[model samples]
Target: MLSMAIGDRIRDFRMAKEPKLTQEQLAESIGIKRSRLAQYEAGRTEPPLTILKMIALALDTTLPELEDEGVPVPRKTKAVQDAPMPNVPQETVDMPYAGLVPADSNWGDPLGTGEELPVDIKFKGENRFVCKVVGDSCYPYLKQGDIAIFEVDPGPSVGTIILAERLGDRACTVKLLEWDAEAGRSRLKPLNEAYEPPSSSPGWQATAKLIGLEFKHEGVKMTAIEPGGFRSRQLAWRGFDI
Candidate 1:
């Protein structure tokens, strides 16, 4: 049987790579089809020992690390290539457009939705703020058009998906937060492998806390992005049980 846990780890490590190995690229490197890689990632199939070893090499990860069950598959703390920061709006003021708040803005108070999405008002608190996605770095799970609802300074734990800002970053980004107390650094893992992995140095501050995501789809609904770094809709529509 395909182990969902293992598959989840495989997918995370693939995305956590320095440059990120796409399904197609990783499959090609291992002499398999992209569909097979997708199946392996989705937990529909388990790869053979040989294929698994190849995957570890292709992702620049150790096979022992892959085989270890206790280890988090992507372990966001791992170092990867550095990427340029994205440009974000400097305005902290709340815009009139759909209750959208910029990440850099002072979001001490809850933003006004102005009757845009049918968000669960119960979750709206002083700590929660809504910020629009600025780039495609976290695609599939978080898109450019999607609006992110974040909780400010919640003191997130390891493997929490967050919308945070690094010291040298121009804007806040959506990433999986992994803390390394020994090294005094944090790794910000992106969902999209095309973009490079981001991390935090000393004096890193989370710009906003990622509570959930609001996607502008056919029907206006609220979905919490899972820590697995995939859209909740794709995972059998188990929306926002978190």
Candidate 2:
């Protein structure tokens, strides 16, 4: 029987690394409400199994690590229990075609094709933005197929993985961010060692910026193809519930 309070353990885990990230940011990463996280941390409420799993994922820990003795059994929400978990990943391809410039199109008069249209995106507090991941840079943590939730004004600090955009590029591939004030530089590192190291060049090289991070939502499991075209892994949701 686990003796520690699961909620306390979770709170400790979150605070251990990201002391600067607000409760709201942590909640967003685990797909929960800020108030709910506060309640859990205060021992006013206990998370259900699904939420527990999401919290574990966000903290980079396992469910067993959050176990506590005398913790009540988790009850599935009525809606979740009634409806089957939606398999949204099946509706789209894992790796989409990139760099489809109009001039390169074999079809004459690409503009007349009427396929490309400009979309007006309205940023709202509740709306979620989907960002397509690129590069094998953050392998084992974030892969090419993963779609990260881009939360504007996330207010991230050091050691956080953010979605930064460069000049003429939509966004950057995922990388761990580190700020060095003494050197007047920010270091972007990959969890995978196979990728090239960050440059020691000058003149604001690479235009690396901090965007939002990939977050998983509880109960939303994504299916992703393995590297060798033989296996698959369920990529869990990594977004916060507003």
Candidate 3:
């Protein structure tokens, strides 16, 4: 049976794009009938893997992005001045903080509820959280003393940095996740070449994928920073909105 959540997400994704597409347009782009697309979006029909793939391509997103449990949509920040701000609509979302998870090890509870952090996200869902990094293995990209908010089990796709915990380990690691379907295994590659990569036979459990973190800003303004400044208090990762 098709869940309403999937249907809603399909419709949401279709409408959220710039120059929002109609059902008929999306159907034509995906090589499916408009009625079939409507049925898929209404949860009356479950889309097969092939159709899902076509939909993903038409939407300009990865397949995992479509099937993920929830999407992360960051809220817009307001100015600090007491003066009347512009009448801009903003959305607020809460993400759980799962305490500190190591970047060099594989361990941590993705569902842990140490605290909740409020941020603006593009996708609205309940399966997101933040965790502090305690190691330097992911240095130069993710830094120690920095925080990471992850979208829990948003499925897996190539080139995504993930928060993974081994089945029998007490620690978790943040690294680039890759899957080898033919070998029936998964590999965890670190951004820092100094650290050797690891692989799991049954495949590492993907608890979450690193979204963005809460960083301190000097003032109530959006400042740009280099990619290396992901650890900085700037909202450089805002590009993930795509």
Candidate 4:
């Protein structure tokens, strides 16, 4: 059976809230084509990230709130799966206080002590690099201390949840990639409810590229980042929950 589209839910909400506002009007206000809006409402196409944000804004609700289904919500918890080393190898020296180790090492048992630890590492491979997750921006799917494996490649497709450097910032952020072809622009969309949508400037827009993603590691939930999938309670981190 076909799964229920989130578009349908969005349409139902829009119609219920603004019966007088035609689809064209709504589309105009939201910066999307009227036909595209119709496609979204009819479940023919998924609404782009921008449109989703616009809809949430127009509705005076967060994206998570707009997409929330009134059901018994599941608790956000992490379960320890079998910890395995990825194909990548450690790049640091065997001795401490040297080069950086493979990011995957943080997830593995340090010194095989059998004691769980909260840490992350960064690695430089011949062709790729990796960085572990250290915060809750991608909570539920990526725990506060889960180690994420990221490829060094900087080209990620639209809708791909990726690890990318925030435009004009020293810090990095994990968010979904949204590309606009006509405008030659893109945006960084956070899964967390607390984060507001980030727009890329023309300069950063051109160079901002996806580094990689938080690969499913042991002791981490492997849920995909979807609209309204994860919720945040605070706004401490720019892209993560406090």
Candidate 5:
């Protein structure tokens, strides 16, 4: 079962390092704040794949080994003679992430990251945001480990799948916005029968319309282009969700 919390996996891998790196050590190595790294380890926040990928690199392990509960990959790879180098993004932003929000996580006000992560520019726009998927709530349409891109639309039309949040509860969920003509309102509908529909409260509202989704992979992020780090990996979302 993929039940292990990602935070725990990060902590385990950090400690399992030969030198047993401290939060400060790891954070420093990755160019992030120790407090931020602390939140990831403590579960106060979910680290997006961009951040998680860096963590994997610093810990001398693969991203899958840290994020997946499937078979573990061996750590301490001594050579990569036959392996292709990782594709690190040059022009990057600390793109906000929303889950594709964890299925079990409940958030508090301001929705930091808004639930956001760094994304490649193809998905960038004034209203677009990237979300890392960690649950099977969207099932066959949007699988776990898929990174979904959504366009901010506070009023997405009925029948559109959306990333929504309940202001009163500060909870985020992905579902189809269904029109209930009889009730003269809309309700969230679950496409997959295995999951329950999202809560419908007065504060419940659409935040963005689902647009794109891609399988997750390890890639470094940089705000500025580094000399000699000019390689690019232009991956399009496997399919347009909308």
Candidate 6:
């Protein structure tokens, strides 16, 4: 009874799909090889709810429909149960001290705080990096001790605040970048009135640009994935949100 129940349901569902889904197509979308899917369809092996969950999603169905009648489906971790998952999961990122950011991956290593933090995945980018704002150099936009996000770029546009360093001294500073065309050099200007601007040649390059940072960490609710048995989320990798 169990053998034919799941196998027949899978085949029927696959055949009923609009334009039809082949064994290979269904398998690949669910992250399994075609042959493995074949075994499940052939009733050669019993698929755990984990695999059944993925198949249900791919087929746009529910686990109860796939399960044999009267067969007790034991409740397991949230990984297999139907429940509203929390917005943020456990993630560790190196919220580095507000300071100079480098071009390479030296600062890329995760500074583990061992605390759970939520990061929205849509904002995730390959060149993304974050640093805490140190002083009032760029006050209004980036206050002291504020979290600043930067994207790695060799040459950021002029008039942009950037994480930069002087070539001769290699001294790092967060300042407004300006190009002096006549002098053929770069100027690192401070926004605060009390701070004096620095004059230097285009001997400096921007490690990254200040794209975004958090002024406040109000809980921003994100739309959850499909509503059904155990919805999935794209876990944000070790990163920052600001």
- Stronger candidate by TM-score (1 vs 3): 3
- In order of appearance, the predictions have TM-scores of 0.42, 0.33, 0.45, 0.35, 0.46, 0.40
| lDDT per residue (tens digit) for residues 1-242 in model 1 | 44576677788877766456688988987789999989888988888887886676555455567766776654444322221111222223332122333244333334454433334443344545556665445544555556666665646766666655445433455676776788887667666555677534433455545555554322224344332333223422211111
Model 1: residue 70 alpha-carbon error in angstroms: 34
> For residue 57, what is the lDDT in candidate 3?
50
* CA lDDT of each prediction against the hidden true structure: 0.54, 0.43, 0.59, 0.44, 0.58, 0.53
- Supply candidate 6's per-residue lDDT for 32: 93
Residue 78, candidate 5: Cα error in Å is 33
- Return the lDDT, model 6, position 221: 28
- Candidate 3, residue 116: the lDDT equals 79
lDDT of 6 by residue, 99-143 (tens): 433222233222232332233443345556556554445544444
Ranking by lDDT: 3, 5, 1, 6, 4, 2
In candidate 6, which residue ranges exceed 4 Å CA deviation? 1-122, 199-203, 217-242
What does the lDDT come to for candidate 4?
0.44
> Which pairs clash in model 1?
150-209, 151-209
Candidate 3 local lDDT, 18-126, one digit each (tens)? 5567999999876789999998889988888878866765664545667775764212232323212212214646667677766444445556656776554432356
lDDT of 6 at 12: 72
Better of 3 and 4 by TM-score: 3
Candidate 5: global Cα-lDDT?
0.58
lDDT of 5 by residue, 98-167 (tens): 4435444464332354555766555556656666765445544455555666677778777666777776
Worst 10 residues of 3 by lDDT: 221-230
> How do the residues 1-242 of candidate 2 rate in per-residue lDDT, one tens digit apiece?
12237767766666654233467987987667899898887777877887876666555444664564343332223233232223323233222112221111232221133332211122112222344454444544554435444333233455555434332323234456667788886766655456675444321123222222222323344332221111112222211111
Q: After superposition, how far is residue 154 of candidate 6 from its true place, in Å?
A: 1.2
Instruction: Kindly give the number of clashing pairs for every candidate.
Output: 2, 9, 16, 0, 9, 4
Q: What local lDDT score does residue 113 receive in model 2, on the 0 to 100 scale? A: 35
Error of model 1, residue 238, in angstroms: 11
